[model samples]
Target chain A: MTIGADLKQCLATIKSIEAGLSSLAINTNAEDEQRLYHEQMMVIEEIKQDLMKRIGEVEREEEQYKGF
Target chain B: MPEWIHIIYRGVLFLILLFLMTKLLGKKQISQLSFFEYISGITIGSIAAEVIMGLDNNIWHGIIGVAIFAVIPFFVEILSLHNKKIRDVVEGKGTVLIKDGKLLEDNLKKEKYTTDEILQLLRGKDVFQVNEVEYAVLEADGKLSVLLKKDNRPLTRKDIDLPSINEKEPHTIIMDGEMIDDKLASAGKNRAWLKQELDKQNVTIENVFLGQVDSSGQLTLDLYDDKIQVPKPQEKPLLLANMKKCQADLELFALATDSEKAKRLYAANARKLQESMDVLSPHLKG
Candidate 1:
């Protein structure tokens, strides 16, 4: 349950960060800043996906334990 | 079914369903997804996928499923638009984080924000110090809106009694040796005028890379071949001088060992020299 909650929080944080970065990219007056913001978002998204897979593995383990 | 045929059919179906749903829900639904809308999206996607793969099954089942999934969200969104209470319940409300330089503990707890999280958000906005913030709101869409203390805020030109900088967007007259006719017409210049301007600089249109007309009515030109024939003041000399002076100033905190500081000074000097060159380079005879 804790892992599930943490995973949800992580996903939410990732989405929020992505949204903020996207807005920054859109509103930034400088082209270089926009590019940096996009790059940061891509990195965050990769991290989010990895966390999601880890959470899935934890859940699978819990289910197997419960079956035993 | 052939792989190509299956792929093409699925693509067409996806497009049709996406179009129908987008039309039903407004454009805003794509960006702002409520919890119900989020679930509806997953459900609709699953139904669409089933329809695409369930070729052996009744085609009407897929059609019915798509229609049902699409119609429900369409009606809910429409109803929410008309009802404020329903909208608030679905979309959630904005929470206040700080008010009058005081952190709202209750609101912070409600939003699940630690002091560290708040600090992180402030730093993301370049706030650095929390005492400088007057008000901060955590918006419903999970975004921060910050208001800084009057004294801590950067003083604009207006605050210092200077005229406002012209904020008009610059127009591109020439891009990669090609003239933009629309921009030329808008700037009240013709092809003949452009040719005359190029002639004065002794530059052919083919040699030009980008030519922009700023709000000041100045034609800023960049050349394709950016080699400086004239011996201009080398930027490296000025950069070295500035670094030496900066290092001596104890308040500046600039160290001789700091390569980042040195690089920044070097780049600044290079940019200044580049700007000067951009202005005067055209006047210099080949």
Candidate 2:
């Protein structure tokens, strides 16, 4: 239960960060800064996807432990 | 007419005529002029000198002579523009002094340039060895143009097949403690933005001797007071370093965390950030 709660919190933080990076990418005037921010946002999106996958894995692992 | 009076009026008349004639002749540097233009220029000067000093018995003769010299060159230049043959005749063709690393003694002799002179011309172009020159032309302007052999040429970015970027020239935004409002517009920046940049450096516009904005939108300033050390603009490097630090923090968090799932999540994110950094290194470093 505790591990599931922690993973969910990490997901929320990652989502918040992803939004911040997206905002930065859109608002900046500098071409290079825009590229860097957009790239970073993409990287964070990948990490978010990976974390979501792991969240499901952790939850399933918890379910098995709960049954035992 | 008093001789002094004659000299004074002649000087004024010749001065006005000379100014007009110069305007008609166009602006070509003395060294860039052809053989005909060179002689005509000297003849015009001699005529003007004689007339201006009241030495020429007939002032009208000097005036007509100057007018003819200036007018002929003007017409010749126009004809040279429309006809290649006339241009070749007026400007003379460039003589090939060396070809395929071999001295063309016949061509050199035709141009009245000796082997020693050719060697000197090659040396002037920083080509020491005669064999290194693939081609050397004595241009019509008397300037030697030399092309080195492929093996002897200097390496450029294209030689190694590096990507080339068309970078815009840096705009001078400030000069001598005054804002160049016109140039600021070309740089795509406003006065308020410039003020903010100045504020960041803790320097006023009054103190800045020079300021330039590069293609990347970086502001660099040279202050009148050099003793006061203004901070170097390292925002790009600093931002890169901060991102790298954030990635390092994630790796550290992964190490310190006890939960296996959280550890894996942090490690994976850190690797993602590292990959992103690798791709962005060139732009950020630039």
Candidate 3:
């Protein structure tokens, strides 16, 4: 996918993760909600890593194609 | 055999036998402890002690006695699980201690719990005032479960009609003056961008005590041993210098007219600014 398409996917993932965390925070018992939030946050971080890697690959490809 | 060795062996054997018997009786046996089971438990321990001390020194006799005790409870549990009437007789039904905020005197009397004991249980749940309780159940395990009156329960964001916003967990990007590459990437950030943001706030990469990025793409920065001293209005201009830089970046990125390109750049720049603000805003004092 293009950089724009990749970024859009990343944004969507982040938004979905945020929704999961918010629902988890409100619905879980007090003793367990913190753990659930932390786990969801880890998933968000993984999405961000994937987005950055894809962005970097796109940039590298663009540079090579430009012969610079 | 030495006296101590014999004593230790007997004690260990007795404990093992007790555990095996308890396991065979199932979880409800301990949880509901019927009159028969309770008496049997005490009697079995006493009998086991006598057998251990060589009163029934024949190991086979001791084993036979234990087998009988264990087998009876084991069968009773299996029967109880299969038959509803037998289960009710064994485990008993849940008794209502408080119904519609009024104490159930008859139920309390049957359960042998005083009003003070009920009050103590409520207090354990952080419900000291009796008026706050709607329903209170005395569980089979001898614990109280309380449901609070609607007015007494704390108002949630939804109850107050506040707009529900998505909340995300913050990611730790730096700790103890070390950059966490994994966290940086997870926050949709890179080393070069982070370094630049840190530089803008007059904080070297090595001087950060803690740095985190929240889900909203906000960066929070703390300097090494830097106490959170709020900057005066006079210092606001200097402290908020990065905020302007962020706005300028957003404006420049906005010049890309193509919707797709503009959106990507917008997200990237927003994340960058967020990282800078996370580091700089505390000092800005607003």
Q: Each prediction's TM-score against the native?
A: 0.51, 0.72, 0.46
Query: Where in model 3 is the C-alpha error above 4 Å?
Result: A1-68, B1-6, B22-41, B54-61, B154-286
Give the worst 10-residue stretch by lDDT in candidate 2 chain B: B24-33
User: What order do you get sorting by lDDT, best first?
Assistant: 2, 3, 1
Model 2 Cα lDDT, one tens digit per residue, B135-210? 9899887889999998899997688865444456789999999999999988778899899999999999999999
- Provide the TM-score, chain A, model 2: 0.86
DockQ for every prediction shown: 0.01, 0.18, 0.04
Candidates 2 and 3 compared by DockQ, better number: 2
First chain TM-score for all predictions? 0.79, 0.86, 0.54
Candidate 1's C-alpha runs over 4 A off are A1-68, B15-30, B33-90, B206-209, B223-286
List the pairs of residues colliding in candidate 1.
none
How far out, in Å, is residue B44 in model 2?
A: 3.1
Give the distance in Å from residue B14's predicted Cα in candidate 3 to where it truly belongs.
2.6
In model 3, what is the error at residue B195, expressed in angstroms? 24
- Quote the positional error of residue B178 for candidate 3 in Å: 23
